[model samples]
Target chain A: MTTATDKSAANSETTAGQWIRMYRQMVSVRLFEEQVNELYTRALMPGLAHLYIGEEAVAVGVCETLRADDYITSTHRGHGHCLAKGASPDRMFAELLGKEAGYCKGKGGSMHIADPATGNLGANAIVAGSVGIATGAALSAKRLGKDNVAVCFFGEGALGQGVLYEVMNVASLWKLPVIYVCENNLYTEYTHFSETTAGDIPARAAAFGLQAESVDGQDVRAVYATAGRLIDRARREGGPSFLVCNTYRYTGHHVGDINREYYRSKEEEKHWKTERDPLKLLADWLVAQGLADSTQFKRIQSEVEAEMKKAVEFAVAAPYPSVSEAGEDVYA
Target chain B: MLETLTRELTFGQAVREALAEEMRRDPRVCIFGEDVAEAGTPFKVLSGLVEEFGTERVLDTPISEAGFTGIAVGAAMTGLRPIVDIMFGDFITLTMDQMVNQAAKVHYMSGGAWKVPMVMRTTLGATRRSGAQHSQSLHAWFSHVPGLKVVMPSTPYDAKGLLKTAIRDENPVVFFEDKMMYTKLKGPVPTEEYTIPFGVADVKRVGRDITLVATSSMVQVALGAADLLEETGMSAEVVDPRTMWPLDEKTLIESAKKTSRVIVIDEGYERYGVTAEIAAVIAEGAFYNLDAPVKRMGAMHIPIPFSPPLEDATVPTEKSVFEVARKLCGQA
Candidate 1:
C-alpha cells in the first residue's frame, strides 16, 4: 500500500493544464485510429497495425512526465506511445502507406515506425525486445550524469520473457534511471492473461525489490499522477521503477480480424469501451472543472478530425519509394 | 619527418589502442561490455580502457549483453558512436533481436533519418578449448541480415585500421575476431591514424595457378597452404575479404577468372556457410572460365569440442585446405 504522504504528493502535482493536454492527446489518438481503420477497411492502406485504443492513458499519462530529450522504447502496439511522445501524424500515416515521406521512409510500416529526432528508438516487432533496450538507454543517461530517464513500454505478456528479469535485476542493481511501464491489456494476441501469465505483474516487480504500482488505466488523471511521481523519483534518485497500467485494447490484436469468438466476448469488450472509456473519463473531469464548455469540446473534436483527414490525404497521395532508395538508408 | 614507429603489438592490443585513440579523437565514441573495467575483459582485449577513458565511456555492464548492446544501439541512434564487446561471439545469439532487428535495420527502417553507427566486437572460433557453448563461428548468421556491415580482421594492422573505419562509418558493423590470433599475431601498425574502407578485398599474395578466398583466421591458414603449394610447384593467389557482408565479389570474380580455379576457406561449418554462397556465386558468374571445380574447405558439420585433437579435427587446418586445393587441381 502507498503511504498517505505519497498519495497526497501525487495529488498535489495535478494541474488543469496537464489534465487538458492528456485529454486532448487521448482524443486525438482515438480520432486518428478511427480514420486509419476506415482507410484500412477500404483497402486504401496496406499491411498490419496493432491498435492501442484502450491503452491511451498509459502512453499519455506517462509521456506527459518526460522531457523532450528523454528516450522511449516501445512494443508493436506503439502508435499511442509515438503520438504521446510527439510524432506527427502526417509522417506516421505516410509510413503506413509505404511512401517516401513516411517516418521510416516506408521501410518500417506500422510495427516499426520511429522518430529518433524525438527520442523514440522505434517500436519493435519482437515481443519483450525493447525492454532491455530501454534499460540500456537509461544506463546511458545515468552514465552521462544527466537527469534524463528512458521509459520502456511493453505488455504483461512480456513478463514471462527471461531477458525482462535479467534487465530488471541489473537496472535495480546499478541504479539505472529507467521506468518499466507494462501496459496490461488483458491479452497477448489470442491468449488470455490469466491462462498464460502466472502470478501478478506488480507482485513480480515488488519481488525484484523495486518500487511498484498499479494504476486504474481508465482514469487518465490517476495514471498521470502516479507516473509523474515515479518519473520524478527516477530523475532525482537515479534508479529504476516499475508500474503496471491495468488497461484493455478495443480492437483485435492486429488489423483485419473479422470475429472475436475465440477468446474474449463482445459483451466484455463493450463493457470496457462504454464504462471504462479513458477519453470519456477525462472529458467528464475537464467539463466538471469548468475548464471548457461542450461547444469548445465539439470544436476540438472537429479540429482533430480535420488534422486526421489531412494526414490521410497526404498518405494516400504520396508515392511509394523508388527501388533505388532501398540501398541509401543502410548507412547515414 | 617520416620517422618510422615500429612497436610490437598483439591483435588485442591493437584493438585497444584503436579504441583509445578513437575515443580521444572523437567524443562520440564509447565502449561497453562485461568485465571490461578492472576485471580486464574476458579476453583482455579491452585491458586498461576503463582507466584511460574512465568509467563513463568505457562502461562495465553487469552481464547484460542484450541490455548494453541495445543501449549502444540507442546511443548510436541518438548521435553517439558506441563500440560494444560481446565476451564471446556465440553470445551474440542472445542479443540477435537488438543486433539484427534494431541495430541493423534502424537506419533503413527510419527512412534514412537515423544511423546506427555502432560496432559489436565479439571473439570467434575455438582457441583455448572454451567448449561448444563458448566457441563458434556464426558470422554467417549476421551476414544473412540486411542493413548491417560485417568485418573480420586477422592482423594487428588490419584490426586497428578496420576497427577505426567501422567506428567512423554511418552504419552498424559486427567485428568478428579470432580468439586464437589475439595474442599470437604481430604486425607493423603505423602510429598515425588510418582507416580501410568496406566492400573491398586485400590481395595478400599474388599467384596464377588458383585463387584462394578466405576470411578471419582462415586467411592465415590459406597463406600457410599457399606456402606449402609454392614449394610443390603450384602457385596460388590469396584474397582476404576483410569485410564479409558487403563482399568484394568483383575482386573475387576477377581473381577466379584469371586463375581459372577457385577455392574457399572458412572457419565456420560447411553447409550454407559463406564459402558455399561464394562458390555458388562464382559457379554462376565465372563457370565457363573455371578450369576446375570450385572447392570449399570448412569445418565439419559439428559443434566445437573441448579436446585439443577433436577441436583441431573440427576446424579447417592448412593441411586440410591444401588437400582440398590439390583435389581441385586433380593432383591427388
Candidate 2:
C-alpha cells in the first residue's frame, strides 16, 4: 500500500515536462468525455457512452508510463486510456460519431475504438472482457522475445469475473510481462462495488503469487510510479502484477443514467468532484512546485477544449461508411 | 491431387501432426490449455508436442477455459499464433464471450486493422458416457457468428490439412475434432506438405440418387449410410463441407441438384444447428432442381444421456441416416 506522502515522493522524480504533459492528457480525456456527453444530449451520437470524467488519473497515470508499442486492452469507459496511449482525438470522435474517419471506421462506436498504431488493442464493451486479451498479449511478448509489456485495464467490477483470476494465475505461472490495472471507481455501474465484491481485492491476485499493490487513483503520480515499477519488472521477466487504484465516478454510469440518486447520494458525487478531483489535485501540486501557474492551467484547459471542438467538428463532417462495407472485414 | 505416397494415421495422430508441422513451420505458433503440456491432455492427442516444442511454447493452464481462451485472442492480435484447447466442447459455454465478442469481432470491429489469427481446438462427440457435461457438438454456435470460421474435419487427411490452414489463416478459427474418431478413425495422410482450402467440399463417395451432406463425425456416418444405400440398390453421394462458416454452398447445391434429393447431417442439435443452415442453403439454392425437400438430421434436442443405449439414440447412426436417405429417395 502507498500513502499520500509516498505518492508525493514518487511524483518528485517525474520531469516537469512529463508532469505538464500528463496534466494536458488528463484534461484532454475530461474534455473529450464532456464532448461525448454533449453529443449524446444533442442526440448526435447513436449509442450509450460510459464517461470517464472522474477516473482520468488512473488511465492517464498508468498509460503515461507505457511506450507507443506497448499493448493495452480497455473497458467500455475507455476514452481516457485510448488518449493516454496516443490515440488521436479526431479519429476517436469520428468513431463515436459513427464516421468513416474513425479508428474502427465507425464499426465500433464509443465503446469499441481500436487503434493499432498506438497499440490500443481495442476497448471492449463486455464487463472484464479484455482481461484475457491483455494477458495473451503478454504471453506473445514473452514468446516472441519482445520487451514490451501489456496493461489489462478493468474496473473493480471485473474482479467478479473468473477470467481475471484465471489469467492472473497463468501470467504468474509463466512469468509473462503484463500488469492487471484495476480501477476501483467506487461504483460498478449503478451499484456500489462493495455490494458485489467479496473478500480482499488485492489478496485475490496475491493468492496467485502476483506482485499486488494498491494506490490512490486520484493521484496521477502515484499510479504512474507504481505502474512504471510493475511494467519495468514485467519487461525484465519479473512476471505479472495486480494494481488496485481506488477512485470514484463523477457521473452516472452512462449518459442516459440521470436518476443516479436512487443508487448513490448526490453528496458523495459532489465531495469527490470538489475535494478529490484529480485535475485540481495535480494542478495544485504543479503550482506548489512553482512549475505551473493559474494562467498556465487556464491556457492548458482552453487548448484542450479547442482541440476537442475541432475533433468533434471533423467527426461530425466525416462521411459514414458505404453500405457495402457492412459485409466487409467480417472475415479478415 | 498429389501423388498417393501416403501413410495411415489415426485422427488423433493426424491432429498432432498438424500441430507439429505448423509449429515447425512457424516460430510464432504456441499452445495453451489445461494439461496441454506434460499431461498432453486426457485424450493424449498432443502427447509429443511438449517434448518437441518445450514448455515455453506448449503451456498447461489451470482449468480456466475462458481465461486462456481470452488470452489467445490478444496474443493473436499482437504477434503470436495461438491454438487454445478447450478440453471438451461442452466447456465452450465458458468461452463464448472471448470467442464470440472478442476474437470473432476484433477484426471487423477494428475495421480490418486488427486480426485474431488464433485457433480454438476442442472435442465434439457423444457416447463416451462422460454424460451431458463432457459430451457436446457445439460447433454450430460458432458457425452462427459472422467473423468466426468453424472447421470440422472427418478424416485424418482432412484434419492435418485443414488444421494447418486454420493455423495460418488471419481470422479466428474453431476446429472441432470428434473425440470418438480420434482413436477409432484412421485414414491415409500425405508425407508431403499440403493444405486444404476452406469452403471446398470434399466428396467422400460419388453416387447419383441422393446427396448426403455431413460434417465431422457425421461424415463417417454418411459414408456408412452410403454403403448401406448401395446394398439396397440406391446410389448415394456423400459431401463434406469441412468448414461451416466459409461453407461450400456451391458444392452442396450442385450435389443436391445432381441427385435431386438432400439430407444434411451434423452431430449438433437439429434445431438452429449446422444441419438447419445447410438444409436452408440447399432449399434456397437448389429448390427448383431438388426432387424432394432437403432433410436434416442431427443430435436429438436434449442433454446427452449417460446410459449407453440412451446416449447412442441421441446422435444419428448409419442405420438411421440410411433409413432417412432411403425414404427421401422414394425406396422406403
Candidate 3:
C-alpha cells in the first residue's frame, strides 16, 4: 500500500540519511547471520545456531526506534536482536565460536549474548522468560520516573507460556512503558502455528486491556512505523503496547537441520521466499526510487563482511577466563 | 559506642531497625512485600517502615511473589539497592526460578559487569501456630545456589550488624530471620554503623566435649541445649554460622578439632539441608579428629503441621540438640 509519494511520509519524521544508517544496520545483521550459518555448516560453531535470515526486519525495525539506553530482552533465537541492539559483531561471533572474547566471555554462547552497557539484559534460552524480565525492567523505569521504555522480543510460540500472561497482566495493570514485540515467524521450531496456537495472539494481549496490533513483519518500514507509534505512545502516556509481526524463516529451525522433511513443504518455502523476501523487497524499493544504487549496497556489504572477519579474528585470539576466575565473578 | 547501648529489643525489631536505618541512610534502599505497609509483615519485622518512608519506598504488593521478587532483581541490577521482604521464607519456593536462576545468576552470568546489589529479608522458623505453608526453614535451598549470598542472624546485635552488612553488600543476599527469636531475644546493639563480615562464626559458648553448629533459631536452641549438656557434665561448644553460603568452615573445623566430636543442628529437614552440608564438611575435614560418627539434629522430614503440638514435635528442640550433643560426646 506504500506508494512513491508516501515515501516522503516515512521520510518526513526521519531523514533519508537516517534511513541509510538503518539500512546499513539491517544489512549488517543479515550478513552476520549468513556468516554464522556458514560457520555452523563448517562445524566451527557449537550447539544450536538459530538462523535469523528471514526475521531481520522485525529486529531491525523495532530496535531502530529505541535509544541505546533503553533495555531489551531477547529470545533463544536472538542473534539478530543482539546485533540490532548494538552488540559488537566480533564479540557476538566470538561467543558463537565459544572463544574467550565473546560478549559473555564464552560462558554464554550464541543464545545468551548480552551487553549490559548497551542495556541488553541477555537473551534467554527459556521461552517467554524474557517477558517477565522486561516487564520487571519497565517497573524499575516507572518507579524511578524515567521515560526509558523496555522492549521484550519473543517468538510466537511464547504465547503459550503462563508467565507471558502474568507479565502482560501486570504490565497493563500498572501501565508500564513497555513494548512487547512478538516475531511471529509462522512456526514454533518445526511445528506450524495452526498446530499449537489458539485464537488471535494480539487478542490475548488486548484481553489484558493493552494496545495491541498485528503488522506485516517482512516490511521493515511498516514494522518501524508501527513500533515508532507504539513507542511514542508509551513514552508520552506511560503505558504498554503489544505488536505481533507476521513473518517467516528461510531455513530450517537450526543450522544443518533440514526441516522440510518433517513439517513444511518446499512450495510453501518458495512461496514465502518469492513473495516476502524482506531484504530483496527493501533493496528493490530503494533502487527504484533512486535512494541508493547496487554499487553502494555492494560497498556496504563488503564493509560489513570485512568487519565480521576482523571480529572473528579478535575473538579467536582473545584469552579465555583464567581458572582462578572461576570464583571471582560469582559474587559482586 | 557499641558497648554503651543496652536494650531489650528482639531480633525482629533489630532487623526492622536495620532496614529503617539503611533506608534513612541511603535513599537508594527501599523495602516492599505483602503486609509490609500497614499489617507490618506477617513476622512484624518491617513494622513502622511504610509509615516512616511512605508507600513509595516501603511498598505493599499483591501476593505476586515471583513478579515482585523478579522486580527486585531488576531494580537491583539497575542500581537500586532494594531490601525486599518475603513475609514467610517458605513462600520463596514459588519464586525460586527468579530468585535462584535470575537473581543469583545475573551477576555471575554477566561476568561481573553487573552486580545484583539487593537484600531479600525473609523469615524461616516454625514456632508459630501457622500451618505448613507458613512455617518452614528452607535457608539451605538458597545456600545451595552458586551466586547467592545467604545470611541468617540469631541474635539482636548480629541481626542489626549483619542486616546492615547485607543491605550494603554488592551481591544478592537472602537474609533469613528466625520467627521464634523475634521477641524473646535481646542484645546490646550499636546505634552507629557496624558490620559483621561473612564467613565469620560467632562462638556462642566454648566447651571441650563436643562442637555444636547451629543456624538462626537453631543457634539459640543449641545454646539452651549446651546449658543442659553442661548440667549433665557434657561440655558442648556452640558455633553459629551467621552466614550460610560462604560458611564459616574454618571456625567450625577448629571447634571440631578442639572438641573432637560434632553435632550439626538446623530447623530445616535432615536430608540435603544445611545440617547435612555441615556434617559432610566435618566428616571430610575432621575425619581423623572425630571420636564417633558426626550427628545431625534437624526437623522431621515432613511439612510442618498446623497443630501446635505436632509442629513443636516436628521442629528440632533444645532437648533434641542436647541429646545429639550428648550422644556425640559419648556421655549418654
Candidate 4:
C-alpha cells in the first residue's frame, strides 16, 4: 500500500543476483507447470491439478520479501506459491503424482501439499480457506515475539467470502503482521469475477481500515516492489495490507475435462496469454534492462525445463504410500 | 503419583482456572474468541484472564467464527497453542469449513508432517433458553471428523483436567462445555495441575443390570436416571466417555459386557447421532455379551425451541432416560 517507495520498480535497489534468482524461480514454476500439464494430458497424474501458469509473478514477487521461517497460506492454484516459497519441484511433482517421497507423502496430492520446513504452511482447495490461518499466524508472531510474517494468497472469488472480511477486521484492529494478497485473475471457476463480485475489491478492504492497494500482477517488478514494501512494513508491526493483483489464468480452472470456452470466448483468453502472460512480461522486462539476454533467458529456460524433467522423472519413479500409513496421521 | 488436595469449584471457575493455569504453565498457550477478553465471553468463563495474561495473550476477536477458528488452526500450525472460545456450539456451523475441512484434515493431509495443536472451546446444550442459534449440543458433529478430537466435560473436575490435557495435545481438539451446567455444576477439582488423557472413560457409578453411556450434559441426566432405577430395585451403571472422538470404547464395551444391557444417551438428536455411533461400536464389538439390545435416547429431531417447556421436551430429561432404561431392562 506504500507506493511512495517503489524501490523494486525496474528491479531498483535489488541486486542483479536477486533479480536473476527471482527470474529463475518464476521460470522454474512456469516450466514445472508445463510438465504437470503434459503429465495430466497423458493421464500419468491422478486427480486434478490447478495450474499456476500465468500467475507466477505474484508468488515470486511476494515470496522474495519473506523470511525462510515466515508463513504463507495458499489456494487451489498453489504450485507457483510453493515453488516460489522454495519447495523443490522434485517433492512437489512427487506430491502431484501421489508419490511416497512427496512433500505430503502423497496424502495431500496437488491442491493440498504442505512443506512446513520451507515456510509454505500449505495450500488449500477451498476459496479463501486460509485467510484466518494467515491472520492467526500473524497473531502468533505478534504474541510470541517472533519476527515471522504470514502472507495469505487467495483470488478475487474469495472477496465474496465473509470470513475474509472478519479476519481482516481483527487483523487491522489488532495491527497483526499479515499480508492478504488477492490475485484477481478475473475468473472464479468458469465465471468472470465481475459476474459474481460487487463493486471494488480494494475499496472493500479499505472499508475494513486496511492499507489496501492494487497492482498489475503481470509485472514482476511492480509486484515485487509493492509486496516488498508491504511485507517489510508488516515485519515492522505496521499492521496488515490488502493487495489486489489484477492477473489472469492461461488455462482452465482445473486440469482437463472442463471446456472453458463455454464460459468465455477464446479471444478473451488469447488477449491475456499473448499480451499479459506474467512470465513473458518479466522475461521481456529483463531483456529490455539488459539484465538478461534472449540467449541467456533461453539458457535459463532450458535449465528450468531440464530441472522440471528431472522432477517428473523422480515423481514418476517414486513409490506410492503404503496402505498401512493411511490410519496413522489421523491424530497426533 | 502426587497426592493433591481437592477444592470445590464451579464448572465456570474450573474452566477459567484451566485456561489461566495452562497459559501460566506454557507460554505457547493463548485464548481468543468473541467477548472473551474485555467482556469475559457470555458465560464469564474467561473472566479476569485479560487482566492476568494481558490483551496480547487473552485477545478478544471480532464476531467471526469462520475467521477466528481458522486463525486458531493457523496459529496452532505454527508455534502457539491456541484455545479458541467459539462462544456457542451452534455457531460452529459458521466454521465448518475451517473445523471439518482444514483443521481436521491438516495433519493427515500434511502426512503427519504438521500438527494443529489447538483447542476450540465452546458452550453446548439447550436448557439455557438462548434460542436455537445459541443453544445446542453440537459435539456430535465434531466427533464425526477424523483428525479432530472432541471432548465434552460434564463436571468441574473433568472440565479442568481434560482442558489441560487438550491444550497439551499435539492435535486439534473441540472441547464442549455444558451451557446450563457452567454455573450449576460443581465438583471437587484438584488444586494441583492434572491432565486426563483422552480415550479414557470414567465410571461414575457401579451397577450390574445395565450400562448407561452418557455424554456432556446427559451425563448428569444418566446419573439421575441411575438413581431412579436404583429406587426401583434395578441397578444401572453410568459411564462418561470424556472424549467423544478418541472414545474409550474399551471401558464402554467392557462395562456393557459386564452389565449385559446398555443404553447410550446424548443431548444431540438421535438419528445418526452420537448414540448411533456408540451403539454401533458396542454392537460391533460386544454384541454377544448383551442380554438386551442397546437402546439410544437423545433430543428430538426438531430444532430446540425457544420456549422453556418445548426446549425441555426436546432434550432428554432424567425421567425420559429412566423410562428408556426401564424399557431396555424390561422393568417398565
Model 2 chain B poorest ten-residue lDDT run: B1-10
Angstrom error at residue B215, model 2: 1.5
Chain A only: give the TM-score of model 2.
0.96
Give one digit per residue, the lDDT tens place, for model 3 in A1-332.
22222332353566656566777888888888888888888887889999888888899888888877788989778998999888889889888877667777677788877788788988888787667678777877877878778899999988877767776777887788889998899889888988899987899999989999989998888888888878777777549999999999888888866747578889988988898878777778778878888898798888988988887777667777667766777887
Q: Write the per-residue lDDT of candidate 2 for residues B64-133, one digit (tens) a residue.
A: 9999999999999999999999999999999999999999999999999999999999989998999999
Candidate scoring better on lDDT of 2 and 4 = 2
lDDT of 1 by residue, A1-332 (tens): 22322433554655666577677799878887887788788987888867888889889888877777888888888888999999999998998888999988898898888887778877888888887668767766776677778899999889878878878877787787888999999989988999989877788877777789999988878887888788888888647889999999999998776587789999999999999999888888778879766787787788889999999898899999999987777767
State the iRMSD of every prediction, in order shown: 2.0, 0.6, 1.7, 0.8
TM-score each candidate: 0.94, 0.97, 0.94, 0.96
* C-alpha lDDT score of every prediction, in listed order: 0.84, 0.92, 0.82, 0.88
**Candidate 3, DockQ to 2 decimals?**
0.52
Per-residue lDDT of model 3, residues B168-259, tens digit only: 99988999988778888887776667788987999999998888898888887888998998898888889998999889888888888888
How many residue pairs collide in each prediction?
A: 1, 0, 0, 0
* RMSD in order of candidates: 3.2, 2.8, 3.3, 2.5
TM-score of chain A of 4: 0.95
Among residues 3 or more apart in sequence or in different chains, the pairs in candidate 1 whose N, CA or C atoms overlap within 3 Å are: A104-B111
lDDT score at residue B265, model 1, on the 0-100 scale: 87
Higher-DockQ candidate of 2 and 4: 2
Give the poorly placed runs of model 3, Cα more than 4 Å off: A1-11, B1-3
The model with the greatest TM-score is 2
Candidate 2: tens digits of C-alpha lDDT, residues A1-332: 22222333345666788789899999999999999999999999998889999999999998887888889999999999999999999999999989899999999988998999999999999989999999989988888888888999999999988888888888998898999999999889878888998889999999999999999999888888888888778877888999999999898889999998889898988999999999999999999989999998899999999999999999999999999989999988
lDDT of 1 by residue, B1-332 (tens): 88878787889899988888899999878887888887778678887878887877877777778867777777777657888889888999888888987888878777777677889999888757888989899998898888889898978988999999888888889999999888898878888778888888999999899999988999999999999999888999999989887888888988999999999888877898989988887888888899988988777898888898888798888898888888788878
Error of 2 at B51 (Å): 1.1
